[model samples]
Target chain A: MCPAMGDVDIDSRTWRLLEPAGLTWRCWDDEYIVFHPWSGMTHYLDAIAGTVFELLLDHDATVRGLAAALANQADTPATDSLNVAVRQVLRRFDEIGLAEPIP
Target chain B: MQLGAVPESALRARFRATGVRLRLAGLCINLRTDVPAVIEQILQLYGGYPLEPGAGTDDARVHLKYASPLRRFIGRRTLVFVDGEPLYRPMLLRHAYLMIDSALDWCVSANVTNLVLHAAVAERGGLAVILPAPSGSGKSTICAALVTRGWRLLSDELAVFRAADGRLQSFALPITLKNESIALIRQWAPDAYISPVFTGTIRGDMAFLRPPTDSVTRAAETAEPALIVSPTYQVGAPLALQPLGKSEAFRLLTASGMNYYTTQRFGFDTVAGLVDSCPAWRLSYGTLEQAVDAIEDLLARVRMDPTASRPAITTT
Candidate 1:
């Protein structure tokens, strides 16, 4: 099931979000460039942010799941601080309309 | 057939009645105006451009006419019309040629679907150099200098590139020089023909420099962009070429380009692809001669190794 942003009672494993509609993206080396058609805004995302959007393309995941996947992609350990940073990136994505919490 | 091939009477009559169609770069332009000065300037500067067979599909029509019949006889002002609607304020009749330039720019910027950049573009050795900047940036001055140095003039303004593939469309129009640039280019290329300077226009003093013959003859061809340089002219500052990051380049390009927001993701890909392919730079120069030399040297290195990244250079 999909999860909405800021649901305090929900566990990290149960929430998921979908990629924004009408969005197109391209990559330049390590940087990902995304075009939001509705807002007509272009966003430049670093490795982690890029990974989050790529992960949410067809599959929705929780903050914890995203952190683990990102760490696995980078061949690093998923620590507590890493989870916090991943959560922050997810919140940014929601703010920028790259992804939305499932209502 | 060149516009010069048409008789003077025929040309003037066509302007009053059927409108004269001319092929300019990738677009066909149909211009109509009864102002004698406007016709004279077109015949003088655009004599080399080919005459279009007819104004049909994909053609832009521009008309510079007096606001009223009485105004034509006495008032010293003219209005510019694009397609069927008036688009700009009336300007002094002496600046009729400038009206043509302004009208054509408006038509292209407002209608053309290409990712048009507020830039001056020139090509040499099959490589196109794009200089995108705001007004009064001396872009035209530097562009005129490069043309005198035998660079093929793509345009004095507007670098229209296809979003599908970043190929540049050339519109080899006369370069508009303001204030000191007129004297500088006249001195630099003594053989170059420059129109009489018109003073007190919106841009202060302005003159149109006739484009090179070869550039006009080859306007139909397109070039792949190789370098994107944002230039600024600073008095007494030695020529400096600084490397600009891709992200910054993308921002500047998107900001200067027209219809980027409308094209959205396709526009983003096109601009990002351009930044990724070319080594962008910011150039600041004091003198015209030094700037020309610096650009030529930089273009040589870019042609040799496009991927080579080096430190910025400040030379006197």
Candidate 2:
């Protein structure tokens, strides 16, 4: 079964992009267009989701870690709301087979 | 020699016997049809296109002929054959022109050498503007308007893009206008030549506008894409031209592509390179004049400085 955000321990899990080498993508205007060869689908990701995707491409990260990175990039504090937003993006990424949590 | 120069009797004999060979957008098409209406329409609409030598190999061979004597007598149906195989169900004989037009488009799209999109392409100052939209979205209407206004008609139906260099090859076939647009064009350009309207077909009241002689004569030229516009015609809406981001442009181009999926990675790279090199916009206008003027203005700006016209998109 696919793990939902509510069912998984968000603080203990780290997510990595699925098939990073196979996915082709280009970023423009802070938005991302990705072509997933596995699914044969082209996905458009907005700023937040695109940022999260870019991070996942580089290395694995937890929700809190991603929130901190986003906060640093935007020159803001890693608040509870930011962490919540990052978690939501991660959940969507999981749903789309873009990222999967390590067992 | 052009198709129009051939005498009626000789044309009929050649079409019935050896097929009429014509050059269209750098490809030789050998079409054989005995239907008088199809022949007459070709003589009128394709008068300026160059005729190829009959002895050489052809890229496509098409035949539009009456179905069985019983079917023709009772139903007045015709069949379209590409390479001696029936392409679709028998259509009304009145729609033979439409079937042949669509079959020619299919032949070009089926070609593996070029990536084709369902778009209207025109050129000015050696640069091309691609108008990609769905049917009834005023694509053909706007394309017809632009051609009448002095833009070279690269194509009114398909945008044939060469993947090797990302250039648009010309396919200046006749512009197929449907329903109200036929009268609209006739009223707008009184001197334009339009075929007799074939009523009660599947596309609903269709007619074709003969492409300009200059476009037909210069069919071998290719133009680099300078701008991409997705147009929409809304009744009573004011003219609006909005800058489109590259990602969105890529999405639109790929969505409109006729054989993008089959072309695979080459399609991806070529489309990406096109969006990178050219700027794109979303154009909506109630009046044709406004859209044409806005496009001309954009083209002027692009000619002046292409970098400034492109939408500012900084990679993350």
Best by lDDT: 2
Could you tell me the fnat of model 1?
0.50
Per-residue lDDT over B1-316 for candidate 1, one digit per residue giving the tens place of the 0 to 100 score: 9898989998999987878988776677898989888999889888988898855664688988987888877987889888888887887788878889888767656666877778999999889889988888889999999998899999888888876677988878889999988888899999998989989987889999989888999987788888887888888888888887777787788888767877767677788778878878888988889888878887888888877643245343
Docking class of 1: acceptable
- In model 1, where do residues sit more than 4 Å from their true spots? A1-32, A37-40, A45-89, B54-58, B307-316
Candidate 2 residue pairs in clash (backbone atoms < 3 Å): none
Model 2, clash count?
0
Off by over 4 Å in 2: A1-14, A18-23, A37-40, A71-103, B235-237, B311-316
Clashes by residue pair, model 1: A3-A16
- Write down the lDDT of every candidate, Cα atoms only: 0.81, 0.85
In the range A6-99, model 1's lDDT, one tens digit per residue, is 5342224433444456676766566777888767888888888888878877588877788889899889999988777777777777676666
lDDT score, candidate 2, position A84: 81
| TM-score to native of every candidate shown | 0.85, 0.87
DockQ for all models: 0.40, 0.41
Clashes of each: 1, 0
